[model samples]
Target: MRKTLLSIASLLLVAGNINATNIGYSKDEISRNNVFRLGSTEKQGQAMRLSHAKLQALKGKTIDFAEFVLGSKNVTDKKMHVFLTKQLDGTPIAEGTVEVKKALSKIKWTLDKPYTITGDEDCLYVGYTTEVATTYKVLMSDGSYDIEGCNYGYKDGAWVDTYGMNKGSALIFVNAENVGDYTDAIIAQSNFEGYYKAGDNCNFSACFVNAGTTDITSFDAIVEVGGNKTTQHFADLSIKPKEGYSFDLKDVDTSSEGEQSLSVTIANVNGAGKETDTSDNSVSANLFLYPKTMERSLLLEAFTGQDCGNCPGGHLNIEAAIKKTEKNVIEVAHHVGYKPDMFTMSEDPTYIFFYPNMSSTFAPAAMVNRNTYANVSTTPIVSATDVNSLLSTIYYADTKEPYVSLYLKTTLDESTRELNVKLYVLPHKTVPHNSSIFNVYLVQDGIEARQANGGDNYIHNRTFRGTVTGNAWGYLVKDIKAGQLLSWEKTITIPESIHSSYYADETKNNVEAVLKNMSVVAYIGEFDQNDNNKHTIYNCCEARLGESHKQTGFVKPTDVNSAEAEQSVSIFVSNGKVHAGGAYDRLQVYNLAGAQVENADLTKGVYIVKVTADGKQTTKKVLVK
Candidate 1:
């Protein structure tokens, strides 16, 4: 069903001819724009697929306007379809079909309504569809660090994820905040526990705020706890009004392990200058430093996808965990390492560059709190055949008191298509590490997509759509103090043109599932600078999204048999024939990297396949073309 996009593009906007902000790539990211299929180009199909190289970075941003640096040649078909589609599934998002009589330079298309994208999937497609093939030139640019090319195509029925490599100078402008100076310094938050280990040199910090209202040159900070005081004089902490800085007490030892209280005071306000409010200078939070250790909630980073045959078992265990002790676990399902997923956050710094460095290269694998669970290697995760054993790992995590507690408050305006997220971080103890960070992500629930083992009707949840603001690990909220209260507010637009959920019937209203299924998840933790035990999710919590109840929906997990594991199945290829053996109930073939490939006329290469019988699974390597 080829549907025309609900477009809001205008033909007249070049009043003064201002240069559009190039959405392809930044100067440092990739600084070159080349003309690919220029003036002589014409539509080869109904739609000419275009990919913006760095479009994923604009995931949570607003797209009010866009520019296409192209010249329209002599065209018979005046009607054109200009649109944006999801990179993973090539689902059309925003678009405008307009007619042109004369050729022009630097054509511009403005959406009547702004498009707010939640899933900045594989690509940001800027394309146009024409029923009658017409002449049009498509712009191009250099390959970015993240993408090989910047354009794509959709024909017949299926979409080519990497159809062709091309770039375009399609500049998309969004409503952004202008930067200003920093002034008004106020005490924000600190991590002060009530108790601590004897002789424990705890991490303590005080967060300071200086927006542009005042000219705060510098400030002196003092962290006192357990009858011990640590004073640090900050020289030039010129902070921006839109941001705050954490001042710290790195190694403050506790007098004893019984009870440790902390208070953070800011003297020399604005570098000893006069300030109106002396009352908001000091702040403190509670913490308990146990003699041995404290209980911390387990963060289950489940790497799953519909294409993973064995992932069903992992889901069963996670569902059990959710039913058993939901608070004891915070599950984040990363839909990668299989097929290109609609919810995979490949744009995330932690996902693209960090988490993979420490996790296994296989699906159905999990990182329990992003740490070595059961003393197993980060790679080759311990077997998860037993749900009880997998559930028991939380015992260790449950024993540790969270060093931080996060609270969330959100207000959504459906009429204006605006989403406002408010985050509050309360520190329990001073974690003096300089590399502390808080990551808040928006997740969608109940996406009915294809799955390898659970059939094509698998539902995905806790799917990381993108970051709240652009920060995956958040800003420098934890760089200075552990037990301080850090508060932040982010306003993002909800795009109307994005794709709807696969199972739209399951949703009560709203075609776009992101807004309805969105959930705000926050985690305040520390990263080990030494690369050992790196990227740890200390404490985590979630806020139910869409208080406005504006087309709200949630995808519940499907029930699977927990008493039995996925049955064993095997596959082998011989004499150009794929064979399924060993109690096999289903035979699924894939190329070496795990993409589903046809079995009839096979290619010549090492291929991995899944053999499943009665939900049981096994993998085998074979040589096929």
Candidate 2:
């Protein structure tokens, strides 16, 4: 063990020149044949490690100084803070008190700076001045800020190159390497079918002040729906070159269900050698999700005006239906020239479209599934009976997978208080049955605005802002085969109405808000499929399935008020009585462990039960034997 320890100690001096010919320590300064132990005592023969200034002149430029020999603190596994504080004469000096233990372990500092040692063994030892003279101070803070540890620099010096004896005490290093610049390039749209069907031939135009440096040219883009075939496109040499070059993708078929995506790869040639280098330059985008319709297909298109006082009641009726069915309903709350809405499109054109050619309308007027029209002025508010009927009648496809997947990248300019939202649209594939199109809707979540009736600060759920792509009358996706990709982007300014200061400072420019609260809902389905396959109402098709279609039902709500409520809605418990009114029912109870505790049939009352839909079995709780 002594030989091995001596060998390790000898290696520390191998990297530097040590001229200690006539050096001799006093009997008290160091004991022969034992490791040095520093203790707090001004003893007669004890030698002191001089302050940095005392050894400054002797510190050779190429000889880096590690920790000076100090007396041990005697605490187990305790690391000491090695600093060049005071000289042997006890004089302090600015810019000389640097920590240097890191230099001792490896003979070189983390920044690759070396040191030169000079002077006699005891008279003086100086570390040559290098860029790393003050480098020791960085390690003093236990590495809060890059003292050569993981995530940035070299591994911790204390652990590496140590023997197995200190294995448990060894420290690991996690440093990050520097990589070149990598960017996602956006190409200009030309012959580009711009959003709003407006850009037409010139929709795909470069919006960037400059293409940064170089444009991405090569990629493989694939679109899919479920496990079925869709559109796929490959660009082996699709380089954008410098700046002005653009690629146009027009009328690509984007019809299917259940999430589509675009994947691109660049040939791996040279590496930037730094993770911070953002030079990969890949281009990607997401397509719209839902299918577009020629005419509006809202399950509930409410025709309301600003002055309507009782419209709140009608609003509640529609809201209740949405909750009951999980709202596959396209509910358009059209308020013509409405004032001070917690949520409203600035133009109010949506309201006018539903009420085309009508100058005014009564309060609380609504069209349920657009199958029938009801006026709050004459008809009593829609009771639970009316709501349930409308909800049950709505046809929706609950099982279709998402054909379109959307990803939104937002850039916030602090100086301009403007947010740039780039939307990408890629199709899963061609609609299997054809006649399918894509629809993209911009939605904002968590808007707290004051509604005159529905609570002062009402939370508007999944409010639609406006449409940017597809046809106002539903654009037909064309010419693209299954597994091909189509993409478009738009930069929109967040309106001041939704930006009202409720939680976040309205004026603060933050990219996170747009990515977090705002999303583009993309979906695709058969534009002509009606409720005959599910549940359909008056010349319109719904996206969600109806009762006739297979579904998982929730436990029915209890405590019905109206006498017309079902006296005994069918339940599937092994032994439990139905509680239409009120009373206790003693029923056979079985625990989940398959043990029977009690059995009896008494009056009807509410009881909790554990249900297993897969096995079609339910165990009821026991009230009495």
Candidate 3:
């Protein structure tokens, strides 16, 4: 393969030097992927699932410049107006206004301005139209999609497509003489951590900023290592403007290891000012030394529900930071999440297709391993207080170490209720270039429910019981090596249902909850329709479906409205019938696990009916046949 793609482009040109060549379609391609936002001053205006930007992946290709890469999750810096339309309801062949202060953004706007696109439906629409700094996002895609210039909305200047653009695919990186430079500063964050021994000394850290409008009093931090290079000048420091100035290189030397290239730069102060864009000074990572011990774990998902009253104080600050830092942490709650409570099961589109806001707009939000939180705000969400403010941030993922090492083992039959997981992955290092996924999730425990204050006997535990590879984004951890060992075999169908309609009385189909408090959670993160910090989490484990033997039932709880729309109630399935009007009043069905069955003949899986009046009750889940 051309000498393995030229020895991986000669180890990324010995690691740093940002722009691998002046080109487009890659600012890590519309980074931080998403949390799905396009102007949300509170909702009621959304679209851009395609506003027309058809370069068809740059048909014949030609470009010197073209920029639009946004990501200011829950934005607030203000001023955003970017476009390039060609039809989705057309009218903007070029537009401007971008200046939203960082949350991991890259607003190049328009530079060098050279364009050329041709044939096969030539389209072009790179978006961004605001309503006072809401949350902006880009770079998202799933399954089959072709470049849908997404989520447009900018009244008072035309450009409206606010339809229900919730399928995914956004993050357009259009460029030519390329690689990013609106005044640069690299080494965003990188370090392999620990043992290299000999003379020790393997450290790293660099922030340094000034992203443009030149004016840097002085700077220097270059560090290479292979052909050797090291510099550190700081003569008279300044740096304020856009703010960023962290430092620490600790002299890196790690004697000699199996793989090493170490690069991190930020220079440009010899004569002070005049660094327009040295390709972001530089940034790269890789160092693996080997020769001994390494252990790591972290899969905490926890999106929480029960009608969030600050989500039971983020579920009592994640069991008080896992019993005061026993930290090996492997939780996976993903309940109803970010709004709706009553313990949302697998509902809300598989936890908003991987937490649309899984890390706090509020809901006890958490994602210790669904990654995010490295360069901060790239997208793991994070925001669960208490427990000493979450023991200084979940023990900082237990001080690093996890290139890959997920271990899972499950096998439950209990009379064909089926479940057969088996994941073992173990990379240890080298296997990241973004594009990995292996979530398993099928949790359950004790069940008790209700928790605006965690009252109704609150005991939800790990909850989230669905997706045994039934698509909560499973598979895609490809043929990695280093201790090889990879396996796959999913088989789930155990959803009786539960999301508050708390039964056990009116025969509402029995469900006091407790499938031996099932458990299966797995992990091995990284995903990027353009790097949302590659969703982080590189290892995880969980396996306790009653140790594969013993069992029990009527513990079905999982399901938050299917098509959204349930602040209290409103469900309608049709044909086989299952419509529980707003406030409910006696209905009853059950099945995925609850038991009441026979709602006079309904088929096709997933049930969880239950309704009632007077004493109060309400729930929904239908899949009819």
Name the best candidate (by TM-score): 1
Q: Can you write out model 1's per-residue Cα lDDT over 417-522, one digit (the tens) per residue?
A: 6666656555545665668767777777787766777776777777766677776557664454543456565667666633323323433323254566777777
**lDDT of each prediction vs. the true structure?**
0.51, 0.31, 0.51
Model 1 residue 136 lDDT?
38
TM-score of every candidate relative to the true structure: 0.39, 0.27, 0.26
Top candidate on lDDT is 3
lDDT of 1 at 28: 15
Tens-digit per-residue lDDT, 483-594, candidate 2: 4444333334444444311224544322123334554443343444232122112112222100111111101113211111321212232234322112224334454466
Per-residue CA lDDT of model 3 for 1-625, tens digit only, reads: 0000000000001113334223221213233444344433432122233111223323454543333444443444465566555554567655667675654545566632445545354445555654433333432322111112233444444555432343233333444322232333322323345434333455556453343323355667778865577887765655433334566775677666346777777766435454543543566566665433334567777776666677776777888787888867877776555554444433434444444443535567676665554444345556676555455446665555466545455656566455555554656456644467777777777777567766877777776756676666677765465544454544454645543333224434334435567777777666664434455566667777635311111011122121112223434455676654335557888887678866655767788876766565656666776
**1 or 3, which is superior by TM-score?**
1
Query: How much is 72 displaced in model 2, in angstroms?
Result: 99
